[model samples]
Target chain A: MIASARSWVDIYLTEMRIAIQQQLQYRVANYFYMIGMIAEPVIYLVVWTTVAEQQGGAVGGLDSGELAAYYIVWTLVRNMNIVFTPFGWENRIREGTFSGELLRPMHPIHYDLGYFAGWKVVVILLWLPLAAVLSLLFHPTATITPLGVVTFAIAIWGAYLIRSLNQSSLGMVTFWTTRVGPVFDIYFTAELLLSGRLVPMSLMPDWVQQIAWLLPFQWTFGFPIEALVGGLSPEQLLGGLAMQALWIAIGAVVLRRMFSIAVRRYSAVGG
Target chain B: MRAISLFLTFLRVGALNELQYRANLAIQLLESGISVFTGLVVLALVFSQVPALNGWSQPELLAVLGVYTLVGGVIGMLIQPNMERLITDVRQGTLDYILTKPDDSQVLVSVREIRIWRVVDVILGFVIIGVALVQLQGTLGPLDAVAFVVALLLGSAMVYCFWLLLTTAAFWIVRMDEIVELFMGLYASGRWPVTIYPDWLRFGLTFLVPVAFAVTIPAEALTGRLTPELLAGAAAFALALLLVTRWFWRVGLRRYAGASA
Candidate 1:
């Protein structure tokens, strides 16, 4: 088991190095992509702060400083948690890209995971300076403690795990259908609404908040953001961490089962 | 005249190609419905706490959202799909076919493909605008109606020119679609009034990307906030950008022809 795990790690590093090299060729494209990533959280910050200001300096329990803090942290949490494998998986499967991946000893997810790892490194490198500039511009107020920071780190990592696994499972369904874009559209809408991408959960209706808590989208984005902005009670933090852990475990099992079935189908069909 | 004929012919062919997969229409309707619903919900959530945002009431903001949806639909249905195909064709050297054709290559590329199902967004936009107008009865005037039309037309022209100029960069750069995505990312700020953003961001939205002109300016017209100077500015900017993009496209074509030679 130890030897097998070591080999897998070696393969993942090799794949990540290759992916990073390929990504470097499209440096211009990546810079443009960052504009979208940075703009989304900024737009939300502007909208919410405007609402807050109109409501006499606080709305939904967040003053302008707190709102700014939440969205700025939100920028990092969002970038850390994004996984785009599902968007391309269907095409890869259809165009025989998966065939070469299948010939390898490792699971195909490892290949995508490596690519995502490299992508995250590249994006974070480009985005960190921008984040600093934004922080200076926004004057975000935070009660950031060391413990809170540690908890946030753990929660965001867990969030990435859950998100990646869930998205991979969604992609795995492409093995059966060609119409996965609509499914992703629905999922995107859910993320937009439930994940506090547009507004704070406190501002949303109670029922929407209830639904958000039930789903993993909020944990992937909102919980870590809120944690860093530092208004969460200890009990809430523990519950959120537990929920994220639960979702990660559930996602792993679900993804493993789906990949097994998908692989079986792919091989049976001569893929 | 020939350009119009070519555009219509491409529109028919594109419609037929999409008609082969009728299920997409239903899927698009579902997706558009969900987006429209989400927009309304977000508006409701915000307005629940406050009556107005930066002097624009909820109804006025809804009007803004309506214009945003409408313009976004037109871009998706007509502008974006064709521009994307143009970029791909350029990369693959399939653009030779269009160059050999008798009609203007720019017109042909600009109207090549249409995503028919995005009409759902257009219809949804109109319905939202209608509802908002009903709620805002008597608040809007005849001059406001004229101003909205003028702003919408100018805004659409500016947005189209901006996209064309960005995509025209494909002649020099291998991956120019990133710039297109950047424009789209900046365009999302149009979901709110441009007045709410910081001056720097507002300037970026207005002058750098033109999202303010495309969505918010029209909404401002409907809300009776359209200044004569701004409307004149929009007309001038739109016309100037149209000419600039045309010149840029010609430069790109020359570069392409030279590179191919």
Candidate 2:
């Protein structure tokens, strides 16, 4: 079993290297993508900072400094958790390349995860210095404790797993329908509101905050960042981590079933 | 007259093509509604704390949001679809068919593809603006109304020219769709008043991506905050960009044809 696990790791590392090389060839596109990744957070940061200032320095228990910290962390968490699969899934299925994925001994999700890991390494290498510069300009304040740091690290990986697996499931839905684009639009809208991508969930309407707690979206991006920014209690962190694990497990099961069904359909249809 | 007729014909074709999939209209409305709802929710969350944002009250900011949505819809409906089609056509060498057409190729390319369901955003935008205007009826004057219309028209024109210029770059860059995404990233900053941003960011939004002209100036006109000098500047910028993009489009076409030959 240990040897098998080592071989799987070896395969993923090789795939990661190849994916990194492929992504680097499109380095210009990567830079443009970097602009987009940073822009949305920066825009919201300015808006929230303005609000905090106008309200006499604090809104919803967060000062301008805290809001800055929240949004910057939000940016990093988003980069870590985002999956690019849903965007290209339709094209792949329609163009018949999905059959190639089906023919492989390994599941396609592993390849996607490897590619995602590679792409994020590139993004972090580019994004961190820029984030540091932004932190200097924005003056974000985070009360980073050892506990918060440890929880954040674990929660972030869980967030990545939850997001990637959930999106892979969504992408697999393209096997049956071409309307996955609209599905993504709806998903993004929900994430923007419920996941605290646009605002601190604590500042959201009470009902929304309640609903967000039950949903996986917050666990994927919001909870980790909010925890790191030092608002959540130990109980809350434990609950959030439990929820993330549950969602990740659910997502993996759902995606595995979806891949089996989709591949069967593909073969039946002579794909 | 011919150009208008051709545009109308293309619109009809697009509408008919989409009519086959009636479900898409519903989906489009749902997505657009969700985005609009999310925007309003964010605005409410911010305003729940503060009474005003940079001297603009919630109602005034609502008007700005309305302008942002309306402009975004128009771009998505008209400019973006056509530009995206042009990029794809350029890539697939299908642009040759557009060039061989009897009418002007530029006009054909600009009106080629339309997502008619985006009219929902345009209508929603108007409704929001109307509601906001009624709330602030006492403050607005006729000049403000006229300026709003003028700014909206000029803003749409500038955005079209800007997008066309970006699409024109497809002649040189194979993967220039990122340029459109870059445009959107900058344009997202237009969700707020431009003056509130830092000096450098403000300048970049104003001249680099022209988001100020496309969104903020129109909102400013409605709020009676638009200066005559700024209006003049926007008008001059629109006219200049129109001329420059037309010339640029011709250059791109020449390069495309030469390379193909």
Provide the lowest-lDDT 10-residue window in model 2 chain A.
Answer: A262-271
Pairs that collide, model 1: none
Q: How displaced is residue A115 in candidate 2, in Å? A: 1.5
Worst 10 residues of 1 chain B by lDDT: B252-261
Best by DockQ: 1
Report the lDDT tens digits of candidate 2 across residue range B43-113. 88877777788898988888888999899999889889999888888877879888887999889999879
RMSD of each: 2.4, 2.8
lDDT of 2: 0.84
The residue-by-residue lDDT of candidate 2 on A13-104, one tens digit each, is 98779878877777666767667778888898888777777778887788989988998887779888877568678877777777777778
lDDT of each: 0.84, 0.84
Q: Indicate the docking level reached by candidate 2.
A: medium
Count of clashing residue pairs in every prediction:
0, 0
Name every residue pair that clashes in candidate 2. none
